[model samples]
Target: MPSGGSTLNAENSGNHTLPSTLAGVDPLSQFLTGPRAQAAFTLRVTMDPPFAIDVQDQAALTVIAAIQGGAWIIAAGTDPQFLAAGQAATVRGPAPYVVADAPDRAATVVIGPGQSCRTPAGDHVDVTMSHGVRSWGNSPDGDTVLLIGTYQSSAAAGQLAVSALPPLAVFDTQETDPALLGLIEREMSRPAPGQESALDRALDLLLLHLVRASVDRADAAGPSWATGTRDPVVARALEVLHAEPASAWTVAELAKRAHVSRATMASRFQAAVGQPPMTYLAAWRLALAADRLASSTATTAAIAQDVGYSSAFAFSAAFSRAYGVSPTGYRRAAEVS
Candidate 1:
C-alpha cells in the first residue's frame, strides 16, 4: 500500500439514498452540534478524470462508503494493506497514504471519522483541501462523488483546539448492513424544520456501529475491549461495577460478589475484560464520568463526587489520565463535537 487514500466502486458500497441539501445548503449540519458527537460534513466530488487525496501533513481516521463504482483502498506505512468494497480498514499511528479510483476506473469513497480527526476546513464540501493534505477521486468510466466527514478525536477533540487522530484508519460499510444505510438515507431525506440534530445523532450512532463491526471482523479471536464479560462470574462482576461505578468497590468485594476466589476473579476478569479488575473499574468509572460531563452542567466537584471521586482535583486528574481531558474540557468539547 502507498501512503494515500483508497477507492471503492459503487458496487463496494451497499445501496444508499442520496443526501439532499436545502436550497443548496446542508440542513444536516444543524442537528450535529453537541457531543452526542456527530459530524455531517459531506461533499459530492464529481471528477472527470483520475484524482487522489494526498495525506502527508494531516493524519486522520476515515469511514468510506462507496455508492456507485468499483474501488479499493491502499494503506501506506511501514506495513500497508489493501481493502476492497464491503470491507473497512482502520488506520492508527502516523502514516502517509492516499486513496484513488485507480487503474483507470471511476468511483466514489465517503471518508468520515469517529472521535479524533482534523481537516483544515471543518465545514467545507468538495473544495480541494489546502492544508497540504487532500483526498479525491479517480474516474475511468464517468464522474465520481465522495461523501466525506472528519471528526475531532476524544484524545484531543476539546473545544476549538485542533488535533490529529491516533492513526489513519478506514471502515467499510458491509453489504449486509442495509439497515444502517437505510437509516443514512432516511437522515439525508428527512424533512427539515426540527429533524436536524436528531438526524445527526443517528448518523453518529451509525458511524459507531460501523466501527464496531469492523473491529469485530478484524478480531480473529474476539474484541479486546469486550474480553471479560462473557463468563457469567466476570460478567456479573462487571455488571456490578458498571451498575455502581460511583460506589466504593474493592477487588475483594467484587470477587465476593462474583462468587469466586479473588485470584480466580482477577484472572478471569483480566482475560474476559482485557484489563485487571481494578483497572477496568477505574476505566469504567472514567467512561461514565465522561458521559456525565458531556450530558450535564453539574460542577466538576459535584460530578467527581457522583462518579466516586473524593475531590474535583483527583477526579480531574483521573479523568485526564484516562481520557486525556479535564472534566470541564470534556464538557466543552462535547458541546462542539
Candidate 2:
C-alpha cells in the first residue's frame, strides 16, 4: 500500500446495506451483469514523487483516470499522453504501458494489475487494486487526478469479450455514465456486513458498465486503427472470433455472424478492422495460444490443441507469420519481461 492508503475495516464503517439491485448476486459474480458492483478505490496524492504500477494482468483490462493531480501515462512502447484532472483513460490494447510525472512528481490511482505503481525513475510502490468486471478510482486530487476502472471476461471466458476494446477515445470523465461511477463506489466501499466476497462482485458490475461505455465511445469516434477497434460490422465479426476462436471458422462463417454477405463482410471488416477476417482470427488465435504458452507449462503441441491448431508445426508456422517470431522465442521474451 502507498503511504496514506490502508485497508478499510468494512466491519467498523457504518454498515451500509446494499441497494435493492445488488441483493441477488454473490459479491463476485454480481458485477458481471452490469449491475451491483461492489469494489472501488479512491486516493488523493499531491505530487512530490510520480507513481506507477504494474498490473498482475490475470484480468483482461483496466481504465485509468486523472481525477485530480495530473500525470502522463507512457505506454510501454508508445509516446506519453498527458491527462489533466477529471479525465479518464482506457488502455486495453496489446502491450502494457507506464505512467509518471514529467517533473519527477505526479500522482495516479490505477486498477487492473494487482500490483504497485512506479515513478519514471523506476521507483515502485505496492498498490492494492481489485479486478473483476468493474473496478474504479475516484481520487479527487484536483490536478490531473484520474478516475480509472477495469473490465474483463469471466474466469471461464478468458480474454473473450474485452480484447475488442477501442484504444482511442476523447479522454474525459464528464462524458461517462454517472450511475456506473456512483455504483462502483458504493459497492466497493460498502461495509462488509460479513461479506468481503460481495465486494468483489460489485467490482464486476462496474467493469461491465465500462465495456458499454467503451462501445459508446467507439460509436461516437467512428473508427481508427490506433484504437485497435472496428466499426459495427467488424466489431461483430470480432465478437464471433473472440467467442470461438478454437472452433473451425472461415471468412464466410464470420460474415454470417455479422449478418452481412460474405464478400461484403470481408471487404467492410478488412477496411474497418485493418485485417482480413481469416487473418484476424488466425492472429487472434495465435496470440491467445502464445499467451497460454508463455503463461502456462503447456507444451507447444498441447497449446496448439487448445487454440485449435492441428499440430505444433502448423501452429508455429502461423504464429511466426503473424508475430515474426517463433512461439518459443516469444515465450522467452515474455519470460525476460
Give the top-scoring candidate (TM-score): 1
How does each model score on lDDT?
A: 0.45, 0.49
Model 1: residue 277 alpha-carbon error in angstroms = 1.5
Candidate 2 residue lDDT tens string, 230-294: 36777676665555556677778778887889998888876775666776656555645655655
What tens digits encode model 1's per-residue C-alpha lDDT throughout 155-242?
A: 2212111111123444554422646545544444444553445445554554555444543443423323333434788878867654
> Local error of candidate 2 at 191, Å?
12
What candidate 2 gets wrong by more than 4 Å, as runs, is: 1-44, 47-62, 66-87, 91-208, 218-240, 253-261, 294-298, 320-337
What is the total number of backbone clashes in candidate 1? 40
Off by over 4 Å in 1: 1-34, 43-49, 55-61, 76-97, 103-146, 155-176, 185-191, 194-199, 211-223, 320-326, 329-337
